[model samples]
Target chain A: MVAPVAVVGALFIVYPLVKLTMDAFTQGDGGFSNFAAVFESAAIRNSLVNTIVMSLVVTVLCVVMGASISWSIARARSAAFKALLWAALLLPFWMGVVVKAYAWSIIFAKNGILNSVLDQAGVIDEPMTLLYTRLAVVVGMTYTMLPYAVLAMNPTMSRFEPEFLNSARSLGSSRTAAMVRVWLPIVAPGLIAAAAIVFAISIGFYVTPVLLGGAETPFMATMIGDDIFAFFNYPRAAASSVLLLVLALVVLGTALKAVGSKALKGGIAG
Target chain B: MTHPPRKLLAAAACALALTASACGSDTDSGSGSDGSVKLTIASWGDPFTSATREHLVKPFTEETGYEVDIVDAPGKFVANLEAQTQANNVEWDLLDSTSGPDAYIAHDRGLIATMPDDVKERLLEELPEDAVTDFGISWSVLGYVGACNAEAVDTCPTDTAGLFDTEEFPGSRTSISTSPLVNLSMAEIANGVTIDELPTHEIDLDRAFETLTEFQDASGAWWSSGDQNLQVFESGEAELGISYSGRAYGLIDSGTPVEVIWQDGLYNPGFWNVTEGSDNPDEAWEFVEWIASHPENAAAWAEALGYSVPNPESFDFIDEKTAKTLADFPENREKLGLMNYAWYVENYEEVNKRWQEFLRG
Candidate 1:
């Protein structure tokens, strides 16, 4: 049974990846020609930079938002309130990524809900440019990624004893100073682990960016799709895919080193 | 050209089963309990294939004894055919409404089969002579035209130059960000290239991109798909923009104050193709011929898809208002420019690379 499961898993996952890597390397004169072509193109390079920047921005946003929500859930006096917070945190599961992206598009559109409300509230004379920009892509991505970040950090936060902070407060440390010294360090591993998860997932995002962001906000995923579908350049697409995969793996491996896999898994599993 | 008669040649071809079998074809056509032959055709899928079924496929099956199996493969003709070619398990007997460029590429790769002479001769009887080629017949016609949210702007630009001139039209604009060819072609028009000169003009990237910058500067949102094109206008995200003529008409029909400008549009068309190694080319040809012979069915099919049929007689069946909105309408056809697909195919690699870069930029 184990043999069968392993074979099937390898066939589905390992086979495609092996084929992709082989295709990436087999282009032109072989052995880095495909990689050279990838580097040679100004568009691919720009998209690579765009992907990293957007993913970093999204990861940061998700980490900040996730930390606050998870903290509230952990510190809430009422057990029922904590459950409700967890339920709200898991609300993203009810909606698909594409649907969420479309919702954001409406929210950001010039005549859409957000703008209309802002205008009615006299926030501005005109609707600000929000849709199809780098900022819009980051917001859409962060919304989708926030839950993962919360899930990763929630476990660590829940396990913490409120008495520890009380003990710090009793030692004449101010509440703000106690949070900076005691609460932050204890949860640092969880934050780092959450960032890794968010960053890794954000790097591979395809639909959210395209739906919420436009051509001006080119991401690596969009270019890879264009190469395969529009130009039918499979080799170039594969090369880019390989590079993206390497980037994600590097991020994950570095996080595994910074916060040991056991601690990261504990934050995820605890 | 007038058609001689409305008789489907496929029925006769099926009656002449020996000749069809003699083409070294698959002996068994996965025949039904009644022992009738079935022909598998690849389609772009709903609502394209849905329209085809309602207008042509069911009628062909009813008139002729052959069954057609539609597999959803929208925008995947070349890719699917290439895969089938490599696997030597060519499944589709026909490809419905394959884009002209895709058909040409597939033909060049020897993935498309030549149409039977009887079917070709019959199709030529009614179809525009130029629409039928060695590989396929042009079945559906579309256009990428200027669209405006009339409620947002006091006046809308009726031509490419007018649309890009932000000061004159004076509204936030949007254009297709996906196709470099469309943006570049429209930009060239803005840069003072005449419509007559546009058919053969190679895009000057430096010149085109400069004007394109001006075009995009006025745009509040750049759209990629038909749905997104409508969303921008519906949500009032964009005031003036590029839109598919079909989608613009749809917006107008749905009570949106969207105006479609046909002047300086791109004449994009889709073709019907018989695939290489087809086990039922005769049946596929018969279906093609049937579409041409029955103009009313063609009109209904085109009506459902918001595309135009090649048959001039089909206009008799279409409503006056909707007929004028189609790409092949006499007035629209006279002014619209078509991209040189052959030219794009030749320079597709370099052009796509630059387009990707420019889009990101």
Candidate 2:
């Protein structure tokens, strides 16, 4: 049984990855020129920077917002309320990514609901520029990845002992102090897991940024797509893909190591 | 322990089956035992395929007892054709393409079949010489025109130059970012050059980008898709934009208070070409011939699509008011400029790199 599973894995996953790496090295007159070209191209460089920046921003936002929601849901007394919260959190995941991106575009449009509401409320004389900005890209990405963060952190938050917070409070800790000194440390493993997953997913975001963002919001995945479909430069696309994979793996591995596997496993198991 | 060995055997058998399936080809021989012919035509998908099936395919199948299958062929047309040809298992009998350097490239690579002499003569007589190549025949034309929300602006842009003149007509503007052809061409026009001079005048990238940067600063969005263009206007993101005439017309028809300027418009035509090594070349030729001969069919198609057929006879079938909005209308045709596809194909890689840099900047 192990032999068959290994054979399948080798044929599909390992073979493609090896072929891609070889193609990246050998295509376009061979050598590491493809990697060189990736670094040299200003467009690709900008996309690289943008991808890293956007992913980091999105990960931070998802953690903050997702942790708050998860904590609230976990502490809620009503099962009905908890169920509703879970449904709301998982709703976006149920929808297609492209559809969600387009929906965000509508909501963020100049005359969209947000602007229209703001305008009617006398909040501003002119419509705010909501769509086609880095802010919009981050917002869309966070919305899409928030569910994963919530799902990751919810289990841990539910299993969290209120005694820790009470004990911190008994030791002369304020609410904020209790949260920072006790609750946060106790939930640190889940937070790290959530951040790792969000960052990994956000780094490869293609549709959200494109549909909701402006020209300045081009991400690494979009560049890879353009390289393959528009430019038909497979070698460059492969090189970029490999770089993206390495970046994601490094970040995820570092986060997992920092959190400690025992803590992570405990958090998940709980 | 016994279960492990059985599972391993099952897995191995499954892997072998998957490998065998992957190596198999999806080839369909044209001839049936009952002597009927079946041909597969690659399409760009609905509603083009849907319209073609309803108007063209159904009629052809009824008139001639041949089964024609319309399959979705979305991206990298030439690459797919080459791969199939190399494998000696060509699946498609015909391919619908935009009449441009791509069709010529396919012809050069011997991926598309050459038109018979009589068919070629008919297409030449109907369409402009440039529109009908030996390997392809122009079916319909779509125009890129200046579009504006009429309700928002008192004075509409009469030509492409007015789109860049923000001082006179102030408000947000948008254009496509994926292809540089329309934007660069319009920029050239805005810089006091006519479409006629574009063939000889080397495209000045610096000048184009300078103007484009100014426009981008003044514009609210840079759309990448047709749906986005419509959204830009409908949602009031941009007061003015350059978009396909069909999209602009759709907006007008939907009561968006938008107008499409036909003057100095850029036009791109669609083509119908038979693929090389088709199992039913004779039936494919017959289908192409039927499409060319029936202008009414093309007109119905163009009307449904909000575009124009290359066959001028199509006008007789469509209403007069609708005909006036078409790309190939006599009045609009005079003001229209055809994109230099040959130049684009030759310089696309370099031009696109610069275009990407400009877009990023």
Candidate 3:
């Protein structure tokens, strides 16, 4: 049953991908024209760079923050505290993306709750421009990815022997040094897998960037969407989609090699 | 209270089949029982679809004894219809709430069935002459006008040109960020281009872009969808922006402090058309006429939906306070300029590329 299902799934994927590849090349003026258009236009190139840079930022934020949350949950002495940490990490998973984006809009609005709180606290004289900016996009994207990153890293972090830290410290090493030398290597696989997941997921983000970042902050996903929906340029959309797919595959492939497929799968499931 | 395993499985299968609307409703519905013919019309989705279903579909189904299912296609109506037409299996019987140029494009491409002389005569009796086309009948009106969050800003732009007067108005402005036509055409008016010069909504690209860049500079939180339009205003992401009359008025009803300005506002008619190879053309056309003739129902719908009915008689049933807010109110109509979407559709490629570039900037 599984073998047949796998074959049918692979066939479904292969057929569409083959058609899309043909359309990408043949639908443009000629071979590679769609790709030429991608490189030729400064706007498309800008979106490509923006998507990459934004994903990088979101990934870094997710990793550092994810690690801290995972460590806290693992190191918690009380069951209630561990559960609390777990609950907080899983909070975003409960809400739909569009709802989260709208909620962020309310919080980041000019006269919104954040501004009101800041004003009451006398933090600033005027409301800063928060909504519809690159910064807002980063904040929203990172908030979404942090939960997944934590989930990915939690297993590896939690399973580690706590006595190793004491043993390293007792062996005449400083706390920071022991952490750097021992703890780093032990959890590096999960961290790498989490980062890969966050980065890949961030690349495909569509709604948050549009709602929070507005038209000015169009991501690569937004660009492809415009080609398909707004402009109805299927070839260009296909080309961009192909490029994005390749980018995602390359990232995942690099991570899988580093962590090994089994370890990476185990890390994610945990 | 639990059923036996076999009984439960049968019930679950029945539920699944009913929920999947396309299961066999596609082919067999044409000859369904009760002699109440089933017709499917492609709709642009809520809140337009909500209003259409309430005022038009429900009454038509009750009066004429025909069944109607609304499919929300949004901007993909023409494209999807074209695909189905090519496949020799045209699914939708009617294309409801098609924008003005979309009707023209579909008609020009021979995608929609031409209005038979008899149907034309019936439609013309209820709707005006200009409103009745060979391929489409004008069903409703849409206005893209300047609107302000009344509580947010001290001043508002009275005319389209004043929208560019950032220092005088003194607030973050926003507008439709997706289409070049809305911003660019309005910008042309702001840049001193007249309706006479731009009868087809064509823009002097150089002049329009300058004003557009200025407008972009002054604006914050530009919107792409109707929900975003309300979101920006409700959250104060924008102080004043170009907003649809329906949404802006709906905001007022919902107790959001939105003030719509009609002077130099852009307007367009929404069309109702029958697809070329529709399963039930007569039923679809009958539904169209039903909507066109019933002014009171139109009025009630407009009251509920905050859009204008094409029929002038709708105003009589509509309350004075509500009438002022409708898109086709004489006073508001006088101040509004009809958008020339034919020009926009003709130059869609250039305009869309320019729009993408402009937004990226």
Candidate 4:
């Protein structure tokens, strides 16, 4: 049983990674020409830059949005409020990412739900082109990443003691002050975790970005996919995949370090 | 140490499961040995696939006594081909694709084997030098024509220039959504410059941007899927839009009041290529010859799939209305432009750079 499991693991995960890495370094007609081309091309660089920018924007948005939403759920005074929060958070999780992106697209399209509603309500004069813009991509990515953040923060948020806020309030600390100084510090690690997840997912996302973004807004993962499948250049695609893994690792390392620093400050880690 | 090793083992097992799942899909098997060659032919998505199988494959099987196995190539054609090629595994025998950079890449990689000798000879005799390539033949011509909801726009824009003239035709429009190919070409044409006369070495990047800006201002949204185009026409999402003629037929079939104008449409042939070093070359070649030859087969293919066939004679096989609707008719055929695919292949890196820069702004 153990041997079979080990063999399966090695064949799938280990072999592919090893094969991909070997392929990336290979140079020839069917080889590193793609990687060389990727490096030489300005489009790839622009896409990489766009991907990073979009990922950062989404991570920031998720942190702020996730923290606020989770805080309300955490501080809910009634069962109904908690139920509502859970319903909202879990509802998105049940829906497919592609389905959600399509829903957002329909709402954001020129003759989409938003424009139609707006038109009926007399809010705007005409429809706006919201489907194939960076703004649309950001919205889509943020929506996809929202549940991860919410789920991550939920447990930590619920664990947060109301007595800490009460103590701060008793000491004449305003509600905002208590949240900023007391509550934020305790939830900071979870917030960092949520941000990291959102950032990592955003950097490598394809579906939402491809559907919602313009040609210029190609993410690194999508570019790698294009190289392997669209371009039929495996060596280059492999190289790009390796690069993506590296980028992801660097991001994860930075996030870990940040979390470690917070843990040390809070005396959670020695 | 025990706990860490257990966790590592678990992680490793999960990774293996994913890899196994990916590899399980790529397997090559011929039809049961009854002297009937079972060839797996792959194309893009549905209605087209179903139509082609219905109209062409079924009739071919009925006549030839060879079983036709039609499959939708996973994801896009190039990616599916790449994965198979990368593993040195050839599950797909015949593939339907246009002469794009990947075809060139595949040819370079020695992934495409020889076509049937007679098919090659026929192509050389019939197709112009620009039509055929070493790797694949011109299967069907892809074009971007001005299709309109007949109810909204009384006159479909006749040419590429008139497409951007929003004031004259006041309604939403869509072009080939993702690929910047048509967009760049149209921009040059709209800018009063022909692509043939433009500097071969250096593409005017500024003109591309200027063209897209005009399109973005005038158009509703960039369409990404065939379904999106179907919805656009069906729901009257756009008054006039550029789409694959095949997709437009789907709308018309569903009783959408949409019509096409093939004037100045970019037409390129979709090609069929066999995987190099396949164990079943004879079987594959047999399937290819059956598909490419026989106007009836091609006509049934076009009728079933809603896509236009390269066989000029196939038009006669379909109904009069359907025949007129084909992208390669005399009224439309003359205006159907061909891009120097070889030029695009060689300078893809440069073209992509300019395309990205243009899109960013």
Candidate 5:
């Protein structure tokens, strides 16, 4: 049974990756010429940088927002608070990533619903041009990614012992200080893990940025997809895919190291 | 140990059920195949395929006893078709594609067979001088025009240049961001160049880029998907969009104050070509010929769709009442201008490279 599963997985996942890596290194009408084209083109370089920067921003935002929201929901005093948090959490689930992006577009577009609403409320004479800005991309991405982040941290947050938090508070620390020191340290692994997950996802994202971002914004996955699917340049697309995979692995490796080191130090101390 | 066997059987059954459910969504019904000549033809959009099946394929199969399978045109179709031809096992009989890349690339690679004699004969009899090319036949005049949000802008922009004029039309604009053709073309028009005088005809990237920047500055969104394009119009997210003729029709039908500007609309054509290694080439040709020339079929297919049939004969049969309801009537066609596909095909890669750099900058 294990052999069969392993064979199937290896054929589907491993074979594609190995093939991609091999294609990345080869050149010509049929070879690695496509990979050469990727590096030669300055546009692809900019797209790569943009993708990394966007991924980092999205990951950091998700980590901070997810931890805070999860904490609120997991430790709420009232059933109403829990219910409200649940409602907030589930709201995004009902709205598709594309639809959520559209909603943001409507709010941000020159004569969008949000602008119209704001104009009706007499907040400003003119509607603010909020759509197609980088801010919109970040906001749209964060909204889509927040659910993943929250789910990742929620289990750890729920299982977290209140005693540890209390002990830190009792030791002459304020609530905010205790959170930064004890609570954050305890949840550090979860945050790192969540960030890694968010980073991997955001790195590979295509639809959100294209819909919400300016023409200048080109993410790696979108670029790769365009290169291969749109332009039909297989080798370059495969090369870019390999590079993206490498970048994802590096991030995952770093996350693992950070978590591993913390655990090692704790083990020695104990 | 008492209930271990029962538990194992139940677990195995549950896993099997889950596996079955996951694979169920993408399965073909095979109702389309009844051991006859199975001709598989693919196109891009869902609406296009539905129209082709209902109006085109159903009639042909009913008349000729051939099984025409209309499938969604995947991006991999061309590459897969090429690979299959090389391996001597071609699957697709007919494929729908744009004139430029589809014709140029596929013909150069020798993946597409010559257009059947009947298709050529019909084209000679019906179409204008410039419509037919060496490799494929032009099927429809696909064009982009200014679709304005009537709610935001009282009057739709009269000319193509108004689309890029931020001061006159100070609202969000939508255009395709992935490919540079539509945006660059609009930009050229914005820069006071007439459709005939566009620098891209000489294939100048710098001039095109300069034009694009002005349009880019005015743009609020760069849409890719059909859904995105339609939503922008319906929800009043944009004041004007460089929208397809079909989408413009849908928006108008929905009672949205959105309107289409026929002036300086950029038009192109799509082709129906047979794969080189197709086993059912005769059947494919029959379907193509029937779909292309059949007036009742083409008119029914074109109505309320994103594409208009390229056949000129189909227009005479369409009643004025129905023609008025359709987006791309003969009167509308006379106003819009089309791009030279032969020119575009020869320089796609070069243009795409420059477009990438222009977007990056």
Candidate 6:
């Protein structure tokens, strides 16, 4: 059984990865020249930086929002309410990313609902510039990835023991102190897992950023896509992909180590 | 519980059945079984597809008794054609390509078939001189013009220079960031080079880049797609932009206060080419010939979609007011610059790299 799975994994996953790695190296003089090209090019460098910055920002926002929602759902008295909350959170994930991005574009357009509403309410004399900006891109990405973050934290939040908080309260600790000292530590692993997942997904976002962002917002995935489709520079695209993969792995590894492997597994499983 | 495993098994079985059925459907829909010849034409999104289907395809089918299937092939036209060629199973009978590097590449790679002699002769006689090529026939021409919001700008600047003239047209502007072909050409035209002189002489790249940099300085955003360009104007993000004439016309039609500056418009023609391995080559040629020969159909298509057909005679069928908005209006045509497709084809890689660098700045 293990052999069958191993064979399938090697054939399906490892083979393609190996091929990509080989292409990245062998395309230009069969060495690390492709990687050098990627680093030296200002466009690629900017895209990489943008990707990291956007992913980090999105990850942070998702973690905070997800944790808040998860805490509420877990602490709710009515099970029906918790189910409804889960349904609401899971709704966006069911829609296609492109569809979601397009929907956001409509909402974020200058004459769109948001501006129309604001203008009607006398918020301002002029319409706000909402579409084709970095803010719009972040909003779209966060909306799409928020569900994942929430779901990741759900199991751990639901399994949280109220007794720990009660015990800390009995010892004359303030509510804030109890949350910071006791409750936070218990949920740290779940938070870490959520952040890691969101970051990993955020870094690879292609459609949302492209649809929502203007010239200032060139993500690494978009650059890679351009290299492959527009420029037909497969080697450079592969090199960029490898670089992004490495960065993602580094971030994930660091998070896993900080959270501890056992705790993360328990958090996810629970 | 044991119930969980049972549910999982049932879901797995359902997924397997769905996958098998999807595969079955693919094979079933691959080809026509009836005796009547069917041809598949790869097309871009609406209103181009809808226009073509309504005015060209339906009429052709009615007249010739051949079934035509319009397949959505936007940015992936070349890739799809290449895949079909590689797989030795060409599904698409005809492809809609721009009469530029794309046609050259297709011709060079033997992906497109040479036009039948009669079809070529008729197309050469009917269409513009540049539109008739060995591999493709020009279907329509879309102009890249300076579009301005009438409500925002007090006096609309009429030339390409006005796009960069911030003080005269003091509002946000945008241009196509993905491709520099139109912008660079327009920049050359802006720097005192006439449309006729552009193809014969080498364009001054340094001067063009300098002018573009000035324009970029004044611009608030850059659009990558036709929809984005329309949105920029429709949403008031941009008061002025270098837009495809069709999109500007769309805004105008939808009651937006937009005006298209015909001066210094860059007219780029899209071509219809029969695929190399087309099973219905004769039928494909007939369809292309019929569409090309019928000026009324071409006019109807042009009227429906805000682009011009290459057949100048089609103007006879088009209304006078709508005809003036098209690229081929004699007065506007004189001012419009034809895209130097050869130059772009030769220097695409270098230009694209430089363009990316420019955008980074």
Candidate 1: TM-score? 0.90
- Which ten contiguous residues of candidate 1 chain A have the minimum total lDDT? A86-95
Task: Compose the digit string of candidate 6's lDDT tens values, residues A66-167.
Answer: 989888887777767766776677667666677898898788877788999999999979888788778999999999988778766766676678899999
Among residues 3 or more apart in sequence or in different chains, the pairs in candidate 6 whose N, CA or C atoms overlap within 3 Å are: none
Highest TM-score among the candidates is held by which one?
3
What is candidate 1's fraction of native contacts?
0.47
Question: Residue by residue across A18-124, what tens digits does model 3's lDDT show?
Answer: 87878788886859889888876667888999999999999999999988888887888877776666666666655667788888988999889999999999998
Name model 2 segments beyond 4 Å from true.
Answer: A1-12, A260-270, B1-37, B78-90, B99-119, B199-201, B276-283
Report the CA-based lDDT of candidate 4 relative to the real structure: 0.68
CAPRI docking class of candidate 6: acceptable
Ranking by DockQ: 6, 3, 5, 4, 1, 2
Best by DockQ: 6
What's each prediction's clash count?
0, 0, 0, 5, 5, 0
TM-score of each candidate structure, all chains considered together: 0.90, 0.89, 0.90, 0.80, 0.85, 0.86
Q: Candidate 4, residues B74-191: lDDT per residue as tens digits?
A: 4456666656676777677777663454566566557777566666776666444555566666666666676778777767677677777777777877765556556676666666
lDDT of 5 at A158: 65
Q: Which pairs clash (backbone N, Cα, C closer than 3 Å) in model 1?
A: none
| Candidate 6 lDDT, B211-304, residue by residue in tens | 8888877775788888888877877778897998878888898888888888877877778889899898988887877877899998999899
Candidate 2 is graded, for docking, as incorrect
**How do the residues B1-361 of candidate 1 rate in per-residue lDDT, one tens digit apiece?**
1110123223322433553344342222232456567788788767888998888889888888688778777666787677678778788888888876677667877999887677778778888886788878887888888988888999988888888888889988888777778888888888888778887888888898888788777878888887888888887778987888888898898778888888887777788888898876777777777787899999999888889887999999999888998988888887788776667777777777777777774
